[model samples]
Target chain A: PRMKLVLVDHNEFAQAVAGADEAEIIEVIDHHRLSGNLRTKEPIRFINEPVGSTSTIVGIMYRMREAAPDKSTAICLCAGIISDTLHLTSPTTTSTDKEILEWLAGIGGIDSAQFVKDFFAAGSMLREHTPDRALESDRKVFEENGWHISISQIEELGLEEFWKRETELQGALQALLTKHSLHFACLMVTDITRHHSVLLVAGDQRVIDAIDYPQAKEHVYDMAGVVSRKKQLFPYMSHVVTKLDAP
Target chain B: PRMKLVLVDHNEFAQAVAGADEAEIIEVIDHHRLSGNLRTKEPIRFINEPVGSTSTIVGIMYRMREAAPDKSTAICLCAGIISDTLHLTSPTTTSTDKEILEWLAGIGGIDSAQFVKDFFAAGSMLREHTPDRALESDRKVFEENGWHISISQIEELGLEEFWKRETELQGALQALLTKHSLHFACLMVTDITRHHSVLLVAGDQRVIDAIDYPQAKEHVYDMAGVVSRKKQLFPYMSHVVTKLDAP
Candidate 1:
């Protein structure tokens, strides 16, 4: 049976709903670049802006329809934009994102600078949480090149904190990979102070074999200059996965 | 004095506000192709859909914010999209435009077949109205290439009907030129059945001098196959205006 769907935030079929192939996506409001050779059977309302967060688009929709999002919604939207763009410092941050964030900040009575600092400080306490909590907290799942894969990132105050918890984190990731039925799983423990990342990978042997980055140990790779997952890690690993799966 | 502005449907400053420079445009939700040197002082949320009507964008906005438009609003929106797309027959009408129009039709309880026939028949009475009413009914004013200009289009059942009213229409257009202080003005009288247009021109001597088309009379030209104002007339006239005014 043909059914109508209005997709928001995400567009990729993997990230979309279950049995997406059966549904007719009438509209897609997204901020991410088009990927997965995406094509619809019929013409759809596809709005993809080069912005930091999907929350910015929602904010614009609120304004256009002459509806004010409640104070909590404004605050939540503001927080999403700020957190997604790393307080307007992320490479993905667009001016449109900044514009909405500012408007939301006004509505929420938020001092943006103070909020970002507080948010980051709280995030840096990831090392204190149990390994399972850290693994689950910031996890993002994706199916890249027919691989049911996932990559989770944690922003830490120091690299030493991540190194101390490395073994336990890998063990937790292994359990997560099996639990989620993921083809592979990776955790990027990033030092927010130093702007460096240490990747802990656990997955199918083929996926592990495909990646040939500067390996720090058996499954850990030192990704020094990479911070953004969508920009740097996703494309890099997608290439590797594609090459390995090629007939 | 800085204030917030959110532009919809149209993009150009000349087409937009009386004093657009005074307010900072925070967002622009539009459907037309971007024209003029559309540079905002600050970053603005620009949502340009490749659809037929700005009303479709508004319809999408209403749904996104979970705000159901009232019946009257729905009818108006449906009519706007239908009229703008020439009852979903125009080349500029995208699938998204059709999709939104169908939804609006359901909401407004519109009989699409009956509505289109009536709309076209109603529009065909252009020559019967007073010259001023005919001129102002479907007029679009623009500032193209430093020339204050305007284009008015009329849908006619027969070319002879427009030819019958040519002199009076020109007289009213001349008054319009003086009233608006336009450098030039054009009225495109399109024969719906024949799919051809007879353009009535009245303006600055230089603009009249520049047109290389077969001069039907002192101020009329035959556009044998041109029907669309946005697609055919605007761009063609823009080039001519720019060339005539080139320093």
Candidate 2:
């Protein structure tokens, strides 16, 4: 049977679940840039807002309908907001996100400050997983100007673990490039506590040389106060690819 | 100064007002197919639903906010609903449209049946306006597979006015094709009462030949029970344009 789907977090089919192209997309509630490729046989309800997280939009929807989620569901929603907005510190954080987070936190009976602390400490990607697995976590691929690129992001409490496995992570990025026949592949390790990140890239030399961010080392750049892949890194990378000399 | 725009009814930039490319689009409330070109520097509220009329969505929004429009506004909304959905008889009309129309009619103290009748009889485009003016009214341009096409629609009480000016409308469509350098241009004259339309087309011979609707004359096709430009004519024309052999 064909699945009837209501996509929540993302709107682009590339970021959606596998076989999403064949499935019927009945509705979409997202908080991302319109990818412009989504089409439906019939008009569907689409609600997209510019906020820190899709969770915030969902919470707003519930309030509009004069309803509230169950306690556990509220907690899950709170977690989503915290993770996406990094405890309301990320630049993508909006007034709506702040409002919705407070409402959900009250409903969930969660100490949001403690939840943020515990959430960041729960799983350190560099410590808990191999470089390959870390790179695959929360990864997104994009096609721009006929070049296919992949950008993977992993958030940790600090950058301590990233320095330890720098070489291995770079190797994994290279392997990813070859494995996927990508023009470029990048893994952004973000420190949520400090609002900083380090990008390790492996790709064509021309593309790499086009990097405008201050280089910390070979094939690595220090991205200070940059924690958002969607808001910060992706657009920068797209600009680089777009300005490159035709292949 | 760049205007901050709140686009209602339509989302595509092609159909938007001039200088829209330079303006800031802060919000959109629409019920059309996503044209995929809309982008914003900041996240904005976008609400799109598959409904017969944007007035229906506007009415629902008013209800959600626990508010009601004033008398004149209510009547205007009712007229929008009646005109777009052809008095709740178009195939595109949804249950929500019916519900909202009834609500607005009650609030505005409207006789919907009489209003619909008077509205259709008020301005017979074929009789009152020149062919050029008639074709430009309620017209939409679309680009598919490198083919730029225009489809203009005019609703009247019967086919009497259309038969009187078919040749002139055909000439105007040809002029529109040349003026815009379009691949094809069509004028759909719909008899709202009978729920039928006749399409007068002029453009590239290849594209003209590909249209499969039963020909009523040399350059006109009979379209029975077709009152919707968005739901019926646009998609069929798009399919025809997309399937033509590569130029």
Q: Interface RMSD for every prediction, one decimal?
A: 10.4, 2.8
Candidate 1: residue pairs that collide = none
Please give the TM-score that candidate 2 achieves against the real structure: 0.86
Candidate 1 local lDDT, A155-243, one digit each (tens): 77778877788888889989998898988999987776666788899988888877777899888989876776766677777777777
Tens-place lDDT digits, model 2, residues A1-247: 8899988877777788889878888888988776665765346788998899999988988987689999999999999999999989998999989988999999999998898888878979899999999998899987777778899999988888999999999899889989989989998989887788998989888889999789999988999999998888888887888898654
Q: Please write out the lDDT profile of model 1 over residues B1-247, one tens digit for every residue.
A: 6887887776666676688757776676876545433433222355667677889888887775568688889999998987777777766777878888888889888898998777777755555689888888778787655788889998777787787888888899899999999988889987766778888988898888888778888799988777778766777887788787632
Docking outcome class, model 1: incorrect
The candidate that wins on DockQ is 2
Q: Over the full model, what C-alpha lDDT does candidate 1 score relative to the true structure?
A: 0.76
Candidate 2: regions farther than 4 A off: A1-7, A13-27, A39-44, A106-111, B1-7, B17-27, B38-46, B59-75, B99-118, B204-218
User: Whole-model Cα lDDT per candidate?
Assistant: 0.76, 0.86
Candidate 2 deviation (Cα RMSD): 3.4
Most accurate candidate by lDDT: 2
Q: Which tens-of-lDDT digit does each residue in B196-228 have in candidate 2?
A: 999988888998899888999999899998889
Error of 2 at B228 (Å): 0.9
Return the lDDT, model 1, position B109: 89
